[model samples]
Target: MAKGQDLRMTQEAHVTQGPLTTEAGAPVADNQNSETAGVGGPVLVQDQHLLEKLAHFNRERIPERVVHARGAGAYGTFTVTADVTKYTRAAFLSEVGKQTETFLRFSTVAGNLGAADAVRDPRGFALKFYTEEGNYDLVGNNTPVFFIRDAIKFPDFIHTQKRDPYTGSTEADNVWDFWSLSPESTHQVTWLFGDRGIPASYRHMDGFGSHTYQWNNEAGEVFWVKYHFKTDQGIKCLTAEEAEVLAGKDPDSHQRDLREAIERGEFPSWTVGVQIMPAAEAANYRFNPFDLTKVWPHADYPVIEIGKLELNRNPENIFAEVEQSIFSPAHFVPGIGPSPDKMLQGRLFAYGDAHRYRVGINADHLPVNRPHATVAHTHGRDGHLYDGRHKGAKNYEPNSFGGPFQTGRPLWQGIPVTGVTGETVTPVHAEDNDFVQAGNLYRLMTEEEKERLVGNLAGAISQVSRDDIAERAINNFRQADADFGKRLEAAVQALRG
Candidate 1:
């Protein structure tokens, strides 16, 4: 019945659309049987259909992402709720009630394409805003802080999360060994082993633009900012037991829950807000403003509501729209730009480079990733699957051809750098102690929350066969808080017994 409807629809669309055609547009008479020498003989060389089918099937899949491979996406709308014209010159936030189309991809870090959706990992909360200016991708995570501050450690950190090469299994020794040495990972480690590690659903947890960004106004005034998408459904989490049960029962539980809810018209929404810091204040701030491993306290920089995002539509083709969708932190409009955050700076190059290798050179030409606004790029002329052209126009810039060209727009200029350039490390600030924030977070948790965190941490840490690695992990926690360390030590010992 489905085949008949598809064929009927195809037939009504074009003159030569109904019949199954070969690559050369020649119609196939018998798709069921291949041309052969005889009834019992091998297939004939003239079987183009068979060859085409097998060849295409071999190249069907592209390389999965190095990280955040397992993901779900949706289409949405972002409507501005406040006047932020004074803060940013971005067209999407230009007015009080302006609307912009968006795409949100939620995923688990360090997970493979087949990993359970309820696994204990940092949830990737990436959003792409398709505005009149261009695509502005706010690549972030569910948590405000990250495991590391420097981009140099990212590859090594992710390697620990992946399977060990020799055994092809996740090893707790590797995870704990790395985290125990890298003290910067303390804050994020505290978050991941907590109750919030296994979120009830993607829509139930808050999203954050983890890195501080730079926003410039029309008046050339600049401000450092961070974005937060507070979930309207409220924060919810599953216990370790609940997560394990659901993983065994339905590996793609979160995906199913989100899809079904949207299909039933139960749209999920988030209140978009920003924590703005003045350009000069960033220098005077107690902590280094660009540290990816730390978070600016809400009390110091209040989260001012700016807009609302509602996911009203699910993807029609998950593989085409969701899987093929690509985003880069470098994809910023005129009003917004990057900060000096090391991780973010690395991603600015890493994402585009990965997309070119994993997706294709012309990934931007794909429907889901293609810009909705008019594009006049001529520099990228030819590559695999090239489908665009700037006919009669010079490919090189500085040509005297009457064409769309780069506009020399004024930048939001304020501060100037006067520093030595070389193999330099991050300058230590007076408030650079990582344990302080982690301790604060541990202290803020309720008694029940603290107990759950200890249990979760113990369950994972106890898996480490080496007592040295386990003790190292405990020592790091001890530095954060004596009580946290004491509870975790007892729980892990109990698990071992």
Candidate 2:
């Protein structure tokens, strides 16, 4: 089924007038009672339907995602509102007013499957655009920056965010200890503890493609771009107190709010924009343009409006649509590719591998993950959930019987590389320290916002048992800004003392 194609064409009504049947389509005479020996002694093994039902029920669930476990998703459309051909030749973005079908999933980063929705955590903003060429997935977060720039440290970072091995609970010592050691975490930590940390609802927060991506035009000109999806519903946030109350009162607060709003026909939308930099300007820039921990300040490159995204429909089945759905940053259309951002590069491999291990290799055959506009003609076959859709077709290329061949044109322009790669720290640019941007963020906040940030930090830092760990964490902020550190240290001391 292609984008804009009728849903009725592919989907059939699940409820029918026929009697209840077994997996083999054989009608079952009695579904209510299981077969037993003489009606009471023992359940009989001869009841194939009973045995089958129990077995299937036992195996109903796939593994939950390691991250973004608790999430809500919706079906939507992304309409290109402005011409961006000068930047890229991606088919979906080739013309103004071109609309593409989309599925957006919002989630809390560090939460479990049963966690509360209103927690003070970064939100996942993963979007899948089913386009004419193929599916383009922009898996991102609400914040524009992350704790670390290198992917090598990602697992370690997430481990600290997750439960402690011994305590079986997240420890303040583990979290602050890692943050203090990794100075790169300062910027994201500041953002995490700020006013917007606890979004009131998924609909009211902004979304970002947090890594730098590559866009190329027809003439093979390359550009580095960052995506921004500003909420049309306006920015709304819950204070720490409000979030605690809401989380306890309604763990599904954000999820329910999104569903009810769409149900009421008040579709939440976002003004889509991008900040683009010429590939030539990447080097010699004030900061490392490819760093995942930094944002391309709006002062250097302003966001240009290009599209609109609105979520209008909730999924009929959460498990089949939301849980089974996968988004990989590696999913790219023509003219769009990844940058040298180490985190982005690592994710290119990790995301797909995780999905293959969790969902079967034929996971894409699931309707929600399938390509809409085009038929995928890959050689991959015969995995779990395999339907044999490509039966009798030659599975290999270079065959006389007309197998699918590769397109001669590359999806994105390639860059030149000269150095032998080993374990090497990324070459630093001017103004590339980890603390500057974080300190700058602190200074940019309003007085009230700064107070809240300090209070949040102090509350968490004071929980650490070791004074050395607390002081080390405070010193990072002090390096970022003296005022920030002073206020935070005073607050922590007052609480701890």
* Whole-model lDDT values for every prediction: 0.83, 0.87
Q: TM-score: which candidate is best?
A: 2
- TM-score of model 2 vs. true structure: 0.87
lDDT of 1 by residue, 466-485 (tens): 99899889888999999999
RMSD (Å) of each candidate, 1 decimal:
17.0, 17.6
Q: Write the per-residue lDDT of candidate 2 for residues 384-492, one digit (tens) a residue.
A: 9999999999888878888888889998887665443233455578889989999999999999999999999999999999999999999999999999999999999
Candidate 1's TM-score reads: 0.86
**Model 1 RMSD, rounded to 1 decimal:** 17.0
